[model samples]
Target chain A: MLKYLFAAFLISICLIVGKALAHYIGFFPGSIYGMLLFAAILASNIFDEAAIGAAIAKIINIMPLVFLPVCVGVIQYGDLLQTSGWKIVAVGMSSTLSVMALVAFICAKILRDERCD
Target chain B: MNAVIEPIIFCICSIAIFFSWLQFHRKFPFALFNPLLLSVISVVLILFLLEIDYSRYMTGGEWISAFIEPGVVALGYPLYKQMHLISRLWRTLIGACCLASLCALTINVLFAKALGIDEWAIRSLATLNITTAIAMETSAEIGGSAALAAVAVMIAGFTGSAFGMLLMSVLKIKNMRAVGLAFGSASHALGAATIARTSMEASAYASTALILCAIVTAIVAPIYIPFLLSL
Candidate 1:
């Protein structure tokens, strides 16, 4: 239980750090930095996972649910979507598929080369 | 008094709906019942029909937002474990993600311009490849609609997960490593999770690609988008 508290405490610190960075950088997503910073701490062994691994996993599992509020904000864009919904979907779908195809093609080529080697 | 009541209602409604959907998802495991998507739909309907304001929904919503950063950071452990495999493909992975980010950003911007989309909406689309938290932040930074960014990211995730595998099979690509990287780069965490059940290595690569792609987008989009706008 103490370790679990520590895990939450550590994450709070990261969030605070992310907020601070936000003040300086115009486009910096402090949260991404927070995760990277925490990951660095974990990678460097500054934070011992044995203390809070299970707790963190359980917290992360509900990560999707956390975004529901933000997703619901889509309701605000009713006018925008009404006018350009299909166009935006077209762009999103095409771009998403484009990235997937490109990444997969590159990975497949690299893997095939590794096989040849 | 209503402030307190509203927040309480938001929490109760969100949690109750999310939990019930999660239970159902566990039993059926169907893609159609994606917990996040369903929760958003249910909550939106509740807010609209009950005449609850978005700000009130945000009161409880703020609690969930508070966890976004830490939750993403917690992913560090699995990523650390997967570091060895990731290192072997580091150069390839980096190259692939960089190109993927470039393509995703560029395509959206071009489409927006051609369609004469509102500049704000275009800004949201610019960072669609990043995680929802970061994407929303980036969208707000560039004067875009944060809500639209979140929605676009979800749409991208659902699209990739629903159609990605079919696309792969059509291409006749049999390697799990490639499959995982494609989904992760395109759809972020949801895609990564979907592929996780297939094989451990694939999931590891997926996680790696997910993190790397987000990092790359965070770094590249600000500089790239402005440059594109100038052009």
Candidate 2:
């Protein structure tokens, strides 16, 4: 459908612009750069609010699908996981918990003030 | 050319991808096991076992990757709707980001060493609270284990939500924004996705979480790693 094509076309442009900016900035991932690009396009009135809205809708709808390629990458590296099963899980779980708790504590302290007035 | 005869394989792989993702959506979803991680690993193994090189595999995966463009492009809508929330909380966001990044990084370093884990192991453990891909890259950049980083990100999501909610109840925290940001920053995309599933407000927090986490990590990793390594 034309909608699909429009979606694809816009994404390609954004991604290209994103990749370019990321290259120039010398840090941050290209995709993150693209998100910034989309934000710029939205803010600058270069892309229609409606069109970008429609595109964003499609992207979120299909997010689960988009992750397909990387899912396979995990499987490819299964052996490393299998061999180091306990160690990876142990370390992964501990770090995840500690970091998550720490971040949560900071957020609760800093952002939880209910003072957005 | 022998290379030209690869669409047949690409076609088959795409179907596998479609199904695996579909199964992922129905079962574990993002809140549980990140199916994308599984899908990528499986595809890579398939290609390696079948003697298909990266180019050919990408030829197959690229067809699927086509969707990634539209998906990324389409992310603007939620962002658009959530613009108000972003504007009102910009200042607090800055403070929260800095605090979260420092506390997260410091606790990770100290506790990891206290456990007597190796530096490489700790390094891998360090970046796991981010999304798998970013975690992987963070892992690679610091010469840590990328898979370990992925697991770390997942663990953060799981425990962040479970304990984060419990702690909020005990602490009598009612500020939705803080709850969302906490879950998002610590848990990254997975936590964000979880909020998206639960409520629009939560989703906004998650979006902020994603942006803030990225900002903080990009800032913190460089400074933190050197300090930790030196110690």
DockQ of every candidate structure = 0.66, 0.45
Q: Per-residue lDDT of A1-117 in model 1, one digit per residue for the tens?
A: 887788888878876787687768645666766776677777787767677778777777766777777788888888999999887888888888888888898789888777421
lDDT of 2 by residue, A14-97 (tens): 888877877888566566566556666676777567754665575565465444543444444456556655564555556555
Could you say which candidate leads in lDDT? 1
Deviation of model 2 at B112, angstroms = 4.6
- Give each model a TM-score: 0.92, 0.76
What candidate 2 gets wrong by more than 4 Å, as runs, is A64-68, A74-84, A99-113, B1-16, B19-30, B37-59, B62-81, B109-125, B141-148, B161-164, B170-172, B196-199
> What residue pairs clash in candidate 1, if any at all?
none
TM-score of chain B of each: 0.90, 0.72
The 0-to-1 C-alpha lDDT of every candidate, in the order given, reads: 0.79, 0.62
Q: Any runs in candidate 1 off by more than 4 Å, and if so which?
A: A21-27, A115-117
Task: Give the C-alpha interface root-mean-square deviation per candidate.
Answer: 1.9, 4.0
